[model samples]
Target: MTRTLRVFRWSPGEAERTREYRVEAARDTTVLDALVEVQRSQDPTLAFRYACRVGMCGSCAVVVNGRERWACRTRLGDLGAGAVRVRPLYHFPLLRDLVVDLGPHAERLRRALGAFTPRAGAEPYARIAGDSRERAAIDEAIECIGCGMCVSACTLVAPNPRFPGPAALNRALTLQLDSRDGAGAARWGVLLGEDALARCHGQGTCTEVCPMGLQPTASIIRLRWLGLSRLLRWTG
Candidate 1:
């Protein structure tokens, strides 16, 4: 059985026209597989990025049939119809077909001081109890692959790129709950600033789109609660 792919493509530095590629595919082939065929057989200039075809890397995220998904995991049959629409992730600078530059997202994660930084009397990484509340909190959020599917779903990131989005805030939340991290106050300060936590509108689409089954909306909710707590404490 042959399937047809309706791939949305726009070459970099070419904004005047968008290119559509219709290609034949096998029933067992995924959209990413069909895309590779189109690129290899006809257009060598097509650009996208993927490291693992097994969906572990999370680098193959694309908009297929109006939903954000891991291309490697999305089979042709999953699309059902003969046509599957493929495009770059939304709310970011499109680098090319099915690819968006995530530099700004990376920068925001850095600004949050994403990794663990300890206080003077903090226990060693090995000393931290596996079943501790902070450990459990961080464990749940640690599965994120930074695929930006949540970013694509977020309406706020469209208007405000400064908002940390789900991935970064999830990263921040993980660190905030770390038992050894002396940086909670500092992390919250950056995350709660005008351009950061204050900007989330709670659309909850980020939770809906995450492939890892993580609830970033919950993290953002916790963040909002923390921010309000701090405000109350300060005002008192």
Candidate 2:
């Protein structure tokens, strides 16, 4: 069967336009596969990034039919039959046809102090129990692939560029729970900044669009609770 792909095409300082290409593909063909076919036979100038063709790399993410998804995992069968509208992930600066700049999101993660710092006298991981509370608390957050999907789906990031967005907050939550982490105070300071977690309106868009099944909204709520507790302690 044949399908039409209306892909967004643009570059730095270039007028944006949508180019439609029709290709033959099976219903089971992945969007990435179809794109590869289009590039091979249709347009050689099309630009997009994909590493693992499986869902692990998180590099082939795009806005498909008004939703953010990994092209490798999203099957043409699932989209039904029609022109598939493909665009770069929203809430990010478009670099080209289907690529967006992820550097901003990475910068936010860095500003959030999303690194781990072991506390004094902390035992090595070999000595720490696998089922310990600290490990359990961060298990889900560690599953994030840094795809920037959460950041793109986040409503706050579009309006408030300074908001750290879900991915960064999720990273902060993981580090915040680390009993060995000695940067809790500093991390909290960043999360409590005027343009940080408080700007999150609990839209849950980030959680819904997360392909990793991670609940970033829940993490933000937990961070809010932690922030409140700290405020109370400071006041008392």
Candidate 3:
């Protein structure tokens, strides 16, 4: 079977354009597979990014048919019989066709203090009970692969670049809930900033487009609530 892919194309200093390519497709063929075939047999100059094509790496994420999806995981058969529209993830600098710079995303994570800070004199190998509240709080959010889909779908980052985005805020959520992490007030300070958690309009676009089934909107809400509780206790 043959399928048509309308892919976004551009280069540094080149006018952006969409190029269509026809490739042989099988029932099990994925968007990634189709792209590889196109690059190999159709257009060798085409560029994209992918690693661990099994969907664990989250590197091959692209906008497919107007929604963010992992190209490797999205099977051609799953999409109706129409041209598959492939484009780069939005809200980031485009490097080339179907590839965007993730540096801004990483910067937001850094601003959110996404790294874990060990508590002073804490146990070297402390174990958290599976049923503990801290464990439950982050269980659903810890699997994020940093694919930038949520960031691309988020509406706030474009207008206010200072907003630490869904991915960064989601990372902060996991670390904030960690009892062993000593970031404490320092982390909260960033989350409470006007451009950080407060900028989230609760649109849920981030949650809707997340490839990992993570609820970054909910994570932001949880962080907001945590910040409020801290404020109340401090005042009391």
Best by TM-score: 3
lDDT of 1 by residue, 116-160 (tens): 787777656545577876677667778998888998888888777
Error of 3 at 232 (Å): 1.0
Model 1: which ten-residue window has the lowest total lDDT? 11-20
lDDT of 2 by residue, 1-236 (tens): 88889999998788999999988888789999989998888789899999999789899999999999999999988997789999999988888999999999888888899877877677766334679877887787779999988887888887887788899999899888777788999888899889888899998999999999999999999999989999899999
lDDT value for model 3: 0.93
Question: Candidate 1 overall Cα lDDT vs. reference?
Answer: 0.80
lDDT of candidate 3 over 1-114, digit per residue (tens): 999999999999999999999998999999999999999988999999998999899999999999999999999999999999999999989999998999988888888999
Q: Rate the local accuracy (lDDT) of all candidates.
A: 0.80, 0.89, 0.93
Candidates in order, TM-scores: namely 0.89, 0.95, 0.96
Superposing all C-alpha atoms, what RMSD in Å does each candidate have to the true structure?
2.1, 1.4, 1.2
The pairs that clash in candidate 1 are none
Q: Which wins on TM-score, candidate 1 or candidate 3?
A: 3
How many steric overlaps are in each model, in order?
Answer: 0, 0, 0
Poorest 10 consecutive residues by lDDT, candidate 3? 125-134
Q: How close to the true structure is residue 235 of candidate 1, measured as C-alpha lDDT?
A: 95
The better candidate by TM-score, 1 or 2, is: 2
- The residue-level lDDT of candidate 3 at 106 comes to 85
